[model samples]
Target: MSFSSLLASSQNHLTPDTNNSLTYTLSELSSLPSTSAQFDVDGAYRLLSTGGFDAGKFEEGIAEMDVGERTAQTQNLETFLEARHSAFINLSLKRSQELSAAMASNLTKASRASSWSAEKKRLQTSLLGSRTYQPPPSSPSHTLVVPSTPGLHASTWSANQSFPPLTPSTSTLSQTTLGATPANKVLWGASRTLDSHAHLHYRHTILNETSTPPDTCPGYLDLLSILETVSPNDLATTSLTWLAEQQRSIFQTFVSQKVTSSSTPITSTDFQEYTTSHNITSWHKVWLALRSSLIPQALTTISTITPPSPVLLTRLKTGSGKIGYGTGDIYRTLIGKLLDFENIQGDSPGISNTEDYIFARLHRLTRGGTVRAKKEDLEGLKEEVLSWGVKYFGNVWSFGLPLFCAGGFEEGISAIKESDEKGNVRAVSLAIVAGRRGLVSREFYEEVVVMYCRSIEGGSPRIAMEYLGEVGRERRKEHVKKLILSTRAYAELAGVVGDDGERVGNEGESTPIDLLFGQGEVRDILRECGDALGREGGGGTDAAELYAMAGEYGRVIEVVNKELAVRVDSFKNGVEDPQRNYWKIAAYNFAEKHLNQGRTHVIERLEREDNLKAGSTFQLLMNLTAFFDKFMEGKFGESWTVLDSLGLLPRTAGEVSNCVDNFFSLDKVARDCMGRVVVAGMECLFNLHASLKQDKSQAAGLTQQGSAGGQSLAQQANIDHDKAMRDIRDRGRLIVTFAGLLHGSLGGEVAKLIARMEAYMM
Candidate 1:
């Protein structure tokens, strides 16, 4: 017979007979009998099918069971879909008959049970959903039999087979209810029982009549689409229904694990709240590329009480899930709902019940600054919050008051330490709390002080500065500076911190830096600021002073040199502008300030720098200053000793190379004025040479006037003239070598000055 006809005939071919018998196929009959062959028509038909029929491994499974136990079974939908598509083949050529007509009937009945139930499930879905939904049966089942060839009558078939009694359960279950047994959970086409995990008959994947979303991970759902299509009226009913199903499944799983009732119950609240990157935030367009969208609408819809009602929002906001930081008006709404605020007194008084403390503390925390209240009233209110905290030390809800109170500071610190030891990640909260009561102490408070400071540094430092006065005066100074520096409040740190440690700027945000840091501490802070600013393209004259005050004379000189280099073009043109001398004057003022502090601190600063050549920075500063003074005074020769060392006046071939090397070796900020330094050095040499030649001519005139008396003076003066003239020749060589070395580097303006220096040599 054909496979489909065999399957159909197998469905009801057996009869109930007391005497059991086994029928083997021609192949099996020819071999030695192995364990008296039992009958399973369902298994035989599946093994004979052409298509992937019953590919669920059902044939392999039912074929193994004894006739007495293999009567009928059913399946649950999720499990049926899980196994239905699996490719299973049985190559064994053995064919057998059904044990009884009941077993034969129930097997097909099991497959039929889930086919229709799954139909009800797919009815609402439109797009993609769980891949586990039962696929349409690829091979149709039938009830009629057809033979492939001319067949013999019943006599031949009867000789080959015998019927057996049906299983006891086969008699118990009718056709439709056949799959209601406890085993239905394990196989296809079975229904869920009371013992199953889900209490809900099905998880609804539909939002409305026209809209059915995929059964997706909770976060992936298009929540706004759900809200918009939810008819506005149904939001009341469906808003949190998903959560109920989720919580029920959790409870069932907890029970199934055999956890005792006395153990901590696993509720939905116990899990960390679900948040997603795809979340739509509140009404504000926080950014152009990213912003809050439907969150405000969802919050308002769920929280409003006018028409649709706020039964859901009230539960979430008033209960543990306060999605506000996301709070202020949120807490006010919730707290107002919880209390008769009109009855609570806010005067200079104390508390009697928990309601009094709750209202007073929450009000102070959320609205104290905005509301109109007397000074004594606010102070007395905060004091009461602290008093109430002592009364209920373990009441974590009112920690607001105890955090600012020094009375129980030691206990609070201990609790924070214990939390850290337990590996609990309460970082942001612990930091804000530590920052508020900014005290550090030894003895009872000593052990916790470091942990508190560390926690403060680790978490939201922005939350701590409000009550900064509570910190010990001595510790506050250092801690405040660290907070400023770490936050990169460089501009604020640059503001003059006086000897008394008060900041000079009027910016209220930087009041901590001003109030807590003294000049001594600020010197170090400024040094770091100067370096950071210098790297980010020179911090200008202000940055130079920062370096100067920090005793980093090299950077001080480097910055001022760069600053004065900016004015080199104007200086070369001999432009008579006061502004041209700005950085030059700045360098002088810094030097005088150093002198006023005792000695010019350049020598001391240079001594500390191990990498430096001891006098290089000091010489740069001295030459830069003296060059500024004497060049302005038309007395370049007076400053020539220091000026030559500034890498400006190279007098030999080797000196030119050294000058170029030093120019490249300096940082970009320090390189800014190098070309100007060269131009200025050339001009100074021409002027110094002229000054020496003029002195030589005056000595000649003196020698001619007083032959005997001025003879020795003129001889000594001519000796000096010969030496100075030789130096001028080397200076001329340097000018030519530099013009070649600098090629195109010194732009059009400095190129003209170098050309003039070469022409002067001619």
Candidate 2:
């Protein structure tokens, strides 16, 4: 069979058979070349498995065929496939280029259309002018207009062409009926009309473009009508858009009008008129407009207005309710706006004294109940006023002090301190003034004292002392103590001694130390005088006198035992020797008074002193001291021994009489002393007599209860009793003699007491 015949046979067998199998004879397969031979099997297998045949792979397989065995049929098939693939690629490339060109052309046309539309709008506006445009109908929603010309290049549009203005009949165009027209397009077409209306309204009202008041402007009336027609939600949008167009013109006109009326200035009436004509309803809007426009001119105009006087400022500070302004809020806003204007423009020549103007205004605003000034604003005003005070008066305290007292007490103090070199005193004075006015706290006065102490030296103490006195007057004990301590610390720092009573430098140079030291010296002298009187134990002296005298005497004797004695001796040694005897008599009288009064503490205190105990006069003083102590303790027997040791007891009646007689010539204190001594002696004699009588009675009882031994004891006891009785009698007689002598010497109360004692002894 031929190769074509074999190929046709394979196709027939592969197509379908009764057994569903392909069979080829060996001769038929061997007739084809080997490389070409696999083609039919591979093609059939590839088509069945992959559902398609790869042309390239089929061609590659053909190239790989043995050169000798490769057939013309395979070459022809590969060439046909390559031609078909190339044709398909060329056709696709041509179609893609055509599509790209079409898109590019469409983009170019669209760009031209956009540019032409913009140019058309610009030219139309220029040709027609803004005045000829009419606003769109008022509606809740915005409307957009689209050009009706389809596929018309925007660049070819003529400027002379105009759209018919909307009549009242067409004014009700609803958003639902304006299908597919964008809101932006509608706004753009109507922008000129809106802008023109706003401009006309602003010019007529704010700028007075018609040479008539805003109240009579047709454009302003139209705007007010429009505002009334629009919903509140739309009003804000409408007003804002209107304001956007007229902002620059309105501001310039407001400023120009203000500048022209510099003398009269724009008052609240002017603002009211302006707002009414322009349909401005809110204070917030007014504030915005003023802030945006007439700030500088307003500042100048406000500065020309006469500043409120301090009295008016004070009244306004406390008075409530509106005066000329509408309400507190409106008044506050007005003042705030004026203040803002002034601050922005700075100092104005309209006011000769800018600081005074600011101060007066600030005082009104801050003190007034209507508005509250910020802390920074108050401080800034204070500084301005303080500078003026310092520059003109050469002392900030002149103004600063008064300002603080008025209302800015703390602020005034701080300002003065900052402005003055020697501001401590000024600050302190201001604080004191504030305190006096009850504007400052007790702590403020204390802080002033502390500041003075730490910052100043010499005069600080004196000033602090004055402040302390003021505090004392308030009965602020704690504050007074703090001031004293602070003054003391300052005195120490200044090297001031408390002992120095004289002024350290000039007459006014005395510090707290001098005052304190002088007070102490006076106290010492008073104490010494008290001690002298106390030790003398004068007739008229009470417990207070005795205690004071004892304390003083204790202190004196502590210094030196002989110190007190020397003082007394000096008084004695003077030509007036009677005074010397008076001193001795007073001292002796005090001792006798203590002995009679049963007071041993004074004698005990005197004997306890080491210095006095070691003195040369210790023996006499001790005997005298012991006599009083023992006598007061009811140790009459012991007191007698002390007196006997001192040789105070007279050896005979004549001597005793003489001693007592001499006491009468002494002063009252001395006489009292002698009288007490005689009384003590008589009491001691009476006690001895009682003891003698008891002893005699006991001896008789012993004798009565007798045996031989008892009898001997009784006899001895009787002998002792007899001797004691005799001694008692002798002592009694001696006391009698002493009393008689005292009765003779002392003629007043002393003599009377001595006579009583003599009678008792008898």
**Among all candidates shown, the one with the greatest TM-score:** 1
Report the C-alpha lDDT of model 2 over 242-271, residue by residue, as the tens digit.
222222222334434443322222333444
Task: Tell me how far the alpha carbon of residue 687 in candidate 2 is from the true structure, in angstroms, after superposition.
Answer: 1.6
The regions of model 1 sitting more than 4 angstroms off are 1-511, 514-538, 541-615, 645-648, 653-659, 666-670, 688-727, 742-752
Per-model lDDT: 0.37, 0.37
lDDT of 1 by residue, 1-762 (tens): 222232333323222112221111211222313433333433432222211122233334354633322211112222222222111101110112213556445446444444434432321111100111111111122111222333221112112222111111111112233223221221111112221211111212211212443222121111111221121222211212211122123223223344343322221111111111224121111110000111212222222222222323222222224323323343233333322112233221222222223333332322113333433443444355454342233323123222322123334434434533321122222222233223223334322333443454434343233223234566655555455445544444445433322335545454434344556665666677677667778477656656655657667666765665555434445553565567666666665665346644454565565435323543464456556566766777665655666555466677887777665666553355556666766777777667667777987787788857657354774467768766875776676577567665655587677667656644
Error of 1 at 663 (Å): 4.1
Which residue pairs show collisions in model 2? 116-154, 116-155, 144-186, 317-367, 317-368, 589-673, 664-745
Candidate 1 Cα deviation (angstroms), residue 499: 8.1
Q: Where does model 2 exceed 4 Å of error? A: 1-400, 403-634, 644-649, 661-674, 704-723, 743-762
TM-score of each: 0.31, 0.27
